[model samples]
Target: MRMFDVCIIGGGPAGLKAAIAAGSQGLSVVLMDDADHLGGQLVKQTHMFFGSEQQRAGARGVNIAKELVEQVTSLVNVEVVLCTTALGLYDDLVLTYETEGSYRKLSAKKFIVATGASERMLTFPGNDLPGVYGAGAVQTLMNVYGVKPGNRVLMVGAGNIGLIVSYQLLQAGVEVIAIVEGGPSIGGYLVHASKVRRAGVPILTSHTIKEAVGVNCVEGAIVCELDSQWQPKSGTEQRIDADVICLAVGLSPLTDILWQAECEMVFVPELGGNVAYRDSTMCTSKPHIYVAGDVAGVEEASSAMVEGELAGLCAAKSLGVSGAHLTLQITSARSQLEELRSGPVGDKIRAGLLQAHR
Candidate 1:
């Protein structure tokens, strides 16, 4: 069994920040992730981010993850375990995970769970077809592996993932016929929606995909308009020929490890599936364990990193590594995090925060 002052799980924007923050504070930290490499989903992202300059605004997620990895790897107190998936958390905060071909146990004096969210997928009649895939998968194939998911695609969901991916598909020389959104308005920001809109792809509102029409692979997408109650309207169905179908409805946190840890949690749909309600320190109902990033709730990479920094700082403090400095750092981080979680869009998520403490 390996031991550390803190174990930060998940190596995306959140876990990477936690590891860096804790190491900077003189805490021995371990970052465990499932991928063969670092960056997590950020590895699959090629576009720049949008936010205040402090959040690395306009920097590609790839560049941001590069800088983050560079910082963490240079720290003597921080260690990274790649190609490892944390399976469960046991008593004394023992982290059970598999790495390479072996299972290992790691114990931490304090723990920060920063495992991020996974892309949420929708199943249609032909969802099982070969060409039907999640936007994240498309990103993985195209952005990370440099392999095109398809030549022509029909995107379902005009949300950020869908729109941004449609634009990416265009960047990769693939054609996007149209994007469909079930909501009245495009599900993502107009900035992103308009980017693709100007490129000549139509954003269809109040629309739903009835099926991906094909026998083995998606040959086309069959779409229909929805009524006020989201029921399919009669005679509005249409088919747009395509070779691929991308689903980008949204994301939900991967919280199975939290479940195994038996952490007190709540299902707040707006926050993006099950999340632990934490105070400013990001500590969960289990005081020794803290939750941050999308696992705490879905927001954006900009805020998730700040939350992870705070969570790591707080966890180090709890375990007596500069516990006194925690207040100052936490104060600064919380202010920034609130900024990211504020605004009109943030307000909707703020109201969805589960206030019932366990």
Candidate 2:
């Protein structure tokens, strides 16, 4: 078994920041990610982020990922392990993982779980067809691999992912037919929604995809209006011609390791789904275990980075690394988080955190 002062189970924005904080404090850190590379979803995002300048507002996510990765790699105290999947977290502070068809174990004085969220799939007829893709899948297909998902696309959900992808599809020279949302109003930032709308893609509120019309793959989609109860209104179904149906409904926290560790979990709808209960410091019920990013709650990457810094600072502090700089950094991180979650746009996330915090 390998031993380290800290083990971070993700390499996304959160995990990367966590490793930087802990490693900068002179702690031996191991940052492991299931993917072959670090940066997580940040590498797939092509749009500029929204936040204060301190959070790198106006910077593209891919650029941010590059900067963070550079910082992490330069830290000699931090080890980067890729293509490693954490299987379980034991009570003895040992984590089991699989890499290259072999099982391995590692123990750390403190652990930070930054495993992000998975895209939620919508249940509809023919949703299992070949052309059906998740929002993340679409981003990866276009932004990462530079492949057009299809010529014409029917986007499901009007959230940030849906709106952003719709615009991305247009930029990729694909035709987006329309964006359908079950809610009465758009769910994403107005700026994103306006961009797609300006591209001549209609956003249908109080509407949903009833089915994906196809034999072996998506040939079209059946969309309809929804009533106050969110039930589909009869006679409102309309067929849309498209080869791809992208689902961007929502995301649920990936907390399997937290569950295995026996950390207290709660289902907060606003936060997406079941998430580990954590304090402001991002520490879970288990003293030595911490969570950040979507695993703690589904929020933007900006907040995830702050939460990651907080978790790493607290974890290092718990491990006897202390100084005025560390204290100031922790305080700044907490304040940044609060500022990020203080607006009308953060209402849902603020409510979710209320129910998720210990």
Query: TM-score of every model?
Result: 0.97, 0.99
Question: Highest lDDT: which candidate?
Answer: 2
- Candidate 2, superposed: residue stretches over 4 Å from native: none
Query: 1-358 in candidate 1: lDDT tens per residue?
Result: 7789899888999999899888998888899888888887777678889877878989999999999999999999898888888887876768888877888888888888888888887877988999998999999999998999989889999878899999999999999999999998887878999899899899999998998899878899889999889999999999899999999999998888778878887888888888876776788777768888888888888888888888888887777766546678878888887788788878857776645234
Residues 1-358, model 2: lDDT tens digits: 8899999999999999999999999999999999999999999878999999988999999999999999999999999999999999987989999999999999998999999999998898899999999999999999989999999999999989899989999999999999999999999999999999988999999999999999988999999999999999999999999999999999999988899899999999999899988887788899889999988888999999988989999999999988899999999999999999999989999999999898
Lowest-sum lDDT 10-residue window in model 1: 349-358
- Residue 194 local lDDT, model 2: 93
- Alpha-carbon local distance difference test for all models: 0.86, 0.94
How far residue 72's Cα lies from its native spot in candidate 2, in Å, is 0.4
Error of 1 at 94 (Å): 1.4
Candidate No. with top TM-score: 2
